[model samples]
Target: MKAGREELMEIIDLWGYSEDAQARIREILESEDVPPPHLFRYYGDRPGKVEQAERLFERTIGTPHALAVNSGTSALMAAIAAAGIGPGDEVLVPGYTFFASASVVVASRAIPVIVEVDETLNMDPEDMARRITPQTRAAVIVHMKGNPADMDPLMRVAADHDLTVIEDVAQACGGSYHGKRLGTIGDFGCFSFDFYKIAQSGEGGFVATADDYLYMRAQSWHDTAACWRPDRYAEERREGELFCGENYRMSEMQGAVALAQIRKLDGYIGALRANKKRIRDQIEERDGLALRRQPDPEGDASTSLVMFADSRELAEEMMAAMRERGVGVGGRFDQTVRDWHVYSYWEHILEQKTVTDEGCPFTCPYYEGQLPDYGPEMCPNTLDLLSRSMHMGISDTWSPEECDRIAEAINSAVSEVLG
Candidate 1:
């Protein structure tokens, strides 16, 4: 049955931080010193925060080196730079993802060759293999909406092509594949602690790498010109200054909050998974709405829950009806990277300065084209899925009863619209 307006209102009301969360924030606020450490403050006196962030990264990610950055996007850009992706180099990314996944490639003056995603809404190994060429230097596999991409096949393909695999774990903070954590699988894993993520430090990100050379390279790019002590670097450090990049360091306050949040991640992920299962049971019987299911692959870890409709219009209508009824839902990736005007028309302003793979013959020719016709049939599944997906915020804050209410609202909205 459709949820009443009151129930919908109650669901929407549950979207904000809980009283307990607010109390924790207040505690943090009261305990902090004046002027709070500058977010990118890397000066003489403020060097201690960087050490705090480094310690936090080591403890949380279980990696030797972690470079705190201002945003997940910057972390991705730095990772690409550290991997040595440059102009004329083609980096394979999913067609159905946030623009940052591809835009970072463009920002590095590299070509982002769009690849089709699987039913999991992650980069498809088959499509990734098809997209690879002599010019392909790396691939950024996004764990879209917190779902772990099929990593074994992806890793195999990357190995075959001699490409560096950079895992975009922005949405899958506490998620793991098989026995290993999501961020630790690839050459480098980038994570986001944005407000909407499972853990939030307001806004911040960190990058993890197992490679000693790449780790130090990423560290320098994150904070160039600063004298970084060798002991701080987990990986083997190069003696000379190789390349210089912009400062993308995170704040001490953000690091402090993130440390606290990291302590709660396992419990939070458990709650979210349980909530998702409850909602899934309630809505599985509906005809018009279909939830994205985790494939039973060799090493798959179920993460966030997402639902899909038949078309964008249907998805939009359902979202609108749910919102009108006071439920807060969102479209997964309705607007694809190709649909963005920035990539299509304003390419000149956003173009990067350095080009790494300048002599590669098979680099993308239509890099500046509004929409390069990779053929209508190239990514049929992703195009179809993108036109029809809707997502619910499966946060730990959502109670089991709240999940039921959301399921009821979705079922009601779909029945009313389709029947």
Candidate 2:
């Protein structure tokens, strides 16, 4: 029998903030600090929460510099701006990732060239290699669904083409590939601390990088070109032309919650990983299901557990059975009209029109009024994979026993669906 909708909703609500995070937020809010110590003000005199969170993120990600931004979309936009991507530039993006992966490229006034994804649901390196043109300036390698993209080949292709690779680690914080962290491998890595991510602070994002110039550029770009001098708390005005940027700075309150969340990230990842393994062990060898493959066999996965069924009917049957058992199951791509994460749902990008009345990026003389098509015609493999794939979301609060039960539910569901 299937679990009631109300019961299933309760099980899914376990993904956000732990006791520690709540306690920390309470502590920060209760303190009687003057001036609020916001990111808009220099923290040297007050030691703001934003700076504290930035440092913590740097340490956790093993990067030299980490900038806290208002959202993952801002991080991606800043990264592209810092990379000097502008009108007529082309950026390669995975066809199956969150819409922001391509939307950010458009935000940079550049055209996004959609690339196909492999079985791992990551950007296909071979297709990436084939898509390179003289106009290609960069690629955004999204770690979609917490799975790392195959970096070695992606890196090689980037190097061969003299293109910058930005790591979109929005769904993959704390995830790694071949002993290296996902965000640290590329020229720059972006992370999201939004409500549903591996770590959450209500809504916040972080950008990590080892390159000093890129870090400084990202910092300036995120804050509307306000020059940051660590020694001086005030943002120095730029004497020359303005560096392209926006008001994407993270607030002290957001930082407070994110810092606490980062502290618990490792533990949360460990628990989720253990639970994923338990579930995988139970379902991996099932006849009708295929365990999600990873770019690196030994790489660490984030909270989501993915699998593919032999057909769409089999997948739907398994999902129905799991739901009946009070275990939530879902497809890889969101089916809701309000959700616009997948490529097929991005009708805006398919149109390739800018908010500008001039249609500058698309109509820029360098582009000669040309734009790449971003419709289903662009990535057949990604469409096929999404049709047959299903995903199981793991929560940090689930105990070992709950994990076992989830695994049993999956096995049982498979048996009932395929039989």
Q: Write candidate 2's Cα lDDT for 75-114 as tens digits.
A: 8998888888888899999988888888888877888888
- Candidate 1 lDDT, 1-419, residue by residue in tens: 43333343343355686767766655675575454334443543655654676676667667777777878998899899888777567788887666788778777877677788877888889989987877788999988777788889999999998899999988888777876778888999998878877677789888888888888788778876544655444443466335677878776657767777877877777777777777777875467777775643222223455778777898888888877766678765444434441122223323432345552222446343232344445567787776687766665677777888887887788777777
Model 2 steric clash total: 2
- Looking at model 1, which ten-residue stretch has the lowest summed lDDT? 341-350
Candidate closest to the true structure, highest TM-score: 2
Candidate 2 Cα deviation (angstroms), residue 63: 0.5
The residue-level lDDT of candidate 2 at 193 comes to 83
All-Cα superposition RMSD per candidate: 9.6, 7.8
| TM-score for each of the candidates | 0.74, 0.86
